[model samples]
Target: MIQQLLINEIDLHVQAILQESGVERPSTLKILTEHPAHLEHGDYSSNIAMQLAKIVRRAPLQIAQDLQARMEKNGRVQGLFRKVEAVQPGFLNFYLAWDTWAQRAEQAAQSLGGIGKNTKVLIEHTSINPNKAAHVGHLRNSCIGDSLSRMLAHAGYEVEVHNYIDDLGNQLADTVVGILHTRTEESFDRFGDFCWETYAKINQAYKSQPELAEQRAVVLHALESGKSNLAWMGNLVAERIVREQLEEMKQFGIQYDVLVWESSIVNAGFWDTTFELLSQTDMFHKVADGKLAGCWVLKNREDEAVAELDNAEHQGDKVLVRSNGILTYTAKDIAYHLWKFGLLSNDFVYKKWGAGLWSTSSQGSKKKIGHADMVINVIDHRQQYPQEMVKLALQVLGYEEAASQLKHVSYGVVSLSPDTAAGLGIAISDGKSSYAMSGRQGIGIKVADLLDHMESVIEAKRSKKTGISSRTIAAASIRYYLLKYQLQTEVILDLEQATEVTGNTGVYLLYAYSRANSILDKAKKDARVLHLEPDFNVSLLEEQEYPLLRHIAYWPETLAAATQQLAPSLICHYAFELAALFNHFYSACPVLKGSESSIRHRLWITQIYKQTLQQALELLGMPTPNRL
Candidate 1:
């Protein structure tokens, strides 16, 4: 808000000068986005003179001198700048009054709004496939999705998050076949585990007898037909695994406002409209001859290059509808996206299925939440081409409005650690296997098991702390671990690094917060709180107080940056920096026995700092424990 006021007032002065000069393109209202390392010039600096130099046909320094003369002539030069220096680069540096920074620092600590006044936005994430156990790779996707959603919401947007479930795919069919081949009876409770085993077994089986490829083809055909036994089983398997995965996501506080089911496209007849639209546009055609005869296809956008090849014999189209008259997964996805943005001129009759477990709104509440204005698919980067094709198909079918809004938040894969001794290497029957984490393979680590194990380790660490309770440590530790890294960066998942209460980990932050809380709790009963007054002089803040004040001053800017960038790592980084600064302040400075009344009052204000930091950390899903 201070920056806003400064920019607004300064802009008014510049505009008035430009009006008087009758000059256009004077670079008025220029922003000085200088980094702090350039503070040798000023906190804020601008090259407005350089911008106007060409217009005036004079040196930048001459232009700056004229601008300064005009401001003095208008009698608007008093009490603004501490000094103005013109550097060789034609940059004019303005040193603000020192008290300005003091006021800004105080405002940061006490301001009610961390999120600036910004436009409403809807952010979607974590649209994991509902056909298998959640893996580290899926963890990357969900983490990025949820963190970005939270960041946008914090930045003053009415963010509505969605998670789509691709419940009716060939992979789901394979799981069903696995269950049918392995299980004696249908069991919804064990369906997830059953699918997991089936996916791996079926894949391995296919490797030995390539004829099983035919079985997979049959399963795919059955899925598209809708009434096949495999289709029915696929539904059951998808529903069951969705339940299990939802429960897993619950531990990490990931949730969705809308549940867009891929299967619902068929049930709701959205695909029929999609096909009709494509056919009307001539975007799709029925093949007349060659290997893909009797199929409907779309010219693969990439095949135009093959057409230019000198000796290319037969690079063909991507089959939208296969020889058996079933649509490919890509075809169905196009319809699904069209329906998501309400561009199909149709809508699905949604049913309240279970309270989807992966949703925060579903937690401690029985009712289901539905309907979204926007949809985002948090899929892997490998699907970029397919998702792009889906968007193209929509545009070609005259759904340009919806196509414009469709978002595919593609994320990189969570690769396996080359080190064999990685954290609790994926569970396998024969040996510890990383392959279990693959949805296609269906052998993988369950999120619940991982959380339970982490919770146990954190609890044990808390017990070792002399006075801290088990619950406090566990909550703090889990929340910290989830947010320690930037979402885009792959977490190496070193157990020791994640579990350590030392270093840049969340536990260290919790301890810092706890130290502050402990100090204030005891101070409240003593004369410190009794004699505290609101007239605390900020100038009395000394030594470590400077860094504490500086860090606290950065909260608003840091928060705004995070929200704008849709990255929570900015906040994570700030939390650690602030915590580290406060820890140093706590060690070196004595709050209760300061030298002067001003010092005492300033020390008390650090309590406000502690409270604010604690609140911000919680927003990042990090905990601030009251005791170490």
Candidate 2:
């Protein structure tokens, strides 16, 4: 908020200077305001003069000089900035008044509201199949998705979350086939755990046993029938497995508002509605005679996902439905996305599920859920082609707006560091430093296992007398670890590094927050400082005090930038730097024990830091424990 203020004021006066000179301002002229590397240079600096040099037909330094001269006389600009200087190389620097910095510090708890402005966002994430337990890779997806949702909500967007359960997919069919073929007396407490093992074995067995692989097709056809015995079993398995996955997610603070089953989309005629619409376009049609004869195909975009489909152009393209009338995964996906954007004529029946969340049911009342301005799918980077195909389908069907709004927030899948992989009993080979998680081969760490491992380490380190829960601390550490990396970069998750209490880890930031709160609590109880509020002259603020306020003042823009970029790592970066700033100030400036005048401002700064960190923790989807 404070940063934008300077940009607007500078832009306003620059426009006036251009108008008076009769020099036409460039339509694309943008005044870029940024934090100066050194505080002595300025609080904020810009190079607007350089950008306007060619158009204004004058030397940049002279233009910058004229802009600075007008800025000093403007009442709004003068009150906020102590000095506006035009420097060498045509740079304009803004130095803020200490009171201006103090005022922004007072507005610490302020949020960036109305960013989305009635725009409804639908975030579809953690849509792992219900055939197995969620693994560490799935944890990354869920953490990023959950954090994105929280950030959007904090930015004042109407956000609805969906977890698309691929109930009728081949994975579920494989689980069913494995259940019948594998003979074991070992019963599973969590059905997801049972399916996890079964699904992995089923996949391994498929390479050598083609006869068993054929059963998947049989199971798939059977699942299409709503009343078959195998179908009934699959339904029972999918629901229970989804519940287990949801519970695991709950442990790490990830929950979806809608549990949309693929069966409902297929069974309830949503696909039929979408098929009819797609049939009218040349993009969707049945191949008359080719390798893909008698199969329905959707034209692949020349630029998207062609590598995933080895045959390009017209050869074996993406099949929507096979010759046997069985629908492909992409076909069901198209129908689901159409429904997601409210483009399909049909809709699902919604009913309240566990924990007051909604789920698509075969029989239930409708809810006002779909019709989003934006639909974001958080899928693996490997699915780039399929996601692009969805957008192509929208474009060919003439829904340009919806096509433009469709976003594929693809991230690199999670892998394990060599140490972590070995710990998970995965054989490290090829002299590789890391191993990618493969659920099909059962070579991955389950989410439950990772959390338990993290919690154990924290428990072993913490005092037994402390009331704070180790599990809460563990969750925060993992969430922060997953979020601290850039979205497109593959993560090599290490349990020891994530749970460590020092360095740039979440545990350290939590302790910093706790320390800030502890200092404030003591001040509140002290009779010497209790009655006196945080009132002081601007000159009383210390060396680290103004910088602390400066960082906190940049918070609104930080959230705004992160949201626009669809990156949660920016929030993590801000939180880590904020904690560092607070800790440095804490050591250099005493809060309750300082001179009375200085102590007042210190306490206020401490209080603001504590509150601000709490907000960052919430946005990151991490819990703010009373102590850590």
Candidate 3:
């Protein structure tokens, strides 16, 4: 990348200056480069001079001048910079040689190789409990996770997407109990929704009747035991709901490489092996007294310290296995992660679940999976504590490398805007930022419902002459809406804002690409432009053209930055900025109607912009429609 090249050049000149001045070089030197607020300040600015002023015992302006002089004299920097100047307040400004940059930019815009290649990365996302229909919040998880997978795969990583199913958890147990008690007529068309309602009703029932909660224990035992009648029913319920969830995810172009079921880990003896490993260490121990007596708990040293320092009445150790010998969700998760890193002696049998997809099994064909170089779990911010404990468990088990490689890609939950809430017939207080969705309250938008609403809205807006289907446009809009936010920032789902065609929504991007295509199509129809390959002239481009070219040339760097920071929002920002630049260029520079040389160059720019937009959209898992 040009930025990296500039950084290297600056580093070399700084080291030479330090050595020549008889000053000991620091162990680490951080060179910071930023775009100047205005173009006249130069293309890139570095504050390294100010950073080194104290160490060199000289004025920053002098240091800046010295660095610029040395850089200007270096033969290697000739083609890279047009002028190396010392700006005010000790800033070293480097202006790019436009001709050289244009050449390199064109090459970068054309080339596709040299990024992440041959690296294996495993991403687990949308691991929703198989008891309820996927809601808007779950859609956020899948969208972010799927986008990350696409970004990594585009960068050349062998990405594996897994959706871990917690089939044996309390949620599923509650669902099973609800199914056994509720004898309502079956509506196969919306069985998943039916289960969602039943699950909510069961929770309400448990509140009024305390005894109904005991049924959860029975269902849990059956699930863990496996091979029993209730276990069969529970498995059947979970599998059906998971299929429904997958169908909902498919509308957004989300796919999975494997489905790791929690029950399979227990039935295949993976958890038993994990238990033995924990028993060998002090991480898991029996609580011999107090309310947690007879339970095998995982001791968290940090929590223990807090307990001692705060003199709290209640200890904070997590229970791994209860007095009745039933394991906690954390225990099963630890086992699952152990298998993920290939740390356990046991493995699950596998069976083909779908085309190019696999699922864990107790008695089926065996295939080698898991053992990823890195594992990213896409969960919500609420699970931060438990996620940390899982990492700590890996450390306690002497797999510090795997522990370090484990990443919890957590994000804030999604909520409805007040307008959306009112539209959904939900009550909201006046001064609230957003209304949180609650699955138990049956108060969240189902993915299927959201898709239906979006498709209807988009169809109403489309012209009769438009060729693209509303379903396609809706899918793109939903995925983009879910992903275009900072990880920690809460997303307020506003239907009107998300579906707008002229703003920073996905529809705007698709429209921009479509406009570029229309121009190219019109040019293709002209015989003079169709057969002509005019001489390329970089100087013919105007001020507005350089910004678009510069942004296009910086695509690889943007991808790398997003990957390094694990932030998909960066990619979103790049796409929005690129689209805005292309729009500006489209308005200011005539493409098909310009002189032959200008026409050819503008067409090349248009093609480059189209390719870049398509790449960014694909990385975000949004389809690039041919026309809007």
True-structure RMSD, every candidate: 5.9, 2.5, 2.6
Clash list (residue pairs), candidate 3: none
**True-structure lDDT of candidate 2:** 0.83
lDDT of 1 at 422: 36
For each candidate, the alpha-carbon lDDT, in order, equals 0.61, 0.83, 0.83
Per-residue CA lDDT of candidate 2, range 440-550, in tens? 888888888788988888888876526468888888888888889998998877766766877888788888888887787787898888876876468886667778877
Relative to the unseen true structure, what is the C-alpha lDDT of residue 480 in candidate 3, on a scale of 0 to 100?
Answer: 86
**Clashes by residue pair, model 2:** none
Backbone clash pairs in model 1 (N, Cα, C under 3 Å; residues 3+ apart or in different chains), count: 2
Residue 8 of candidate 1: its Cα lDDT? 53
lDDT of candidate 3 over 450-475, digit per residue (tens): 88988998888877537578888888
In model 1, the runs with Cα more than 4 Å from the true position are 2-32, 38-42, 45-122, 182-194, 221-232, 282-319, 353-375, 397-402, 420-446, 463-488, 531-536, 599-608
Query: Model 1 compared with the native: what TM-score?
Result: 0.78
Q: Each prediction's TM-score against the native? A: 0.78, 0.94, 0.94
Model 3: residue 61 alpha-carbon error in angstroms: 2.2
**Candidate 3's TM-score:** 0.94
lDDT of 1 by residue, 304-355 (tens): 3212222232333556786777777778877767755656755654445457
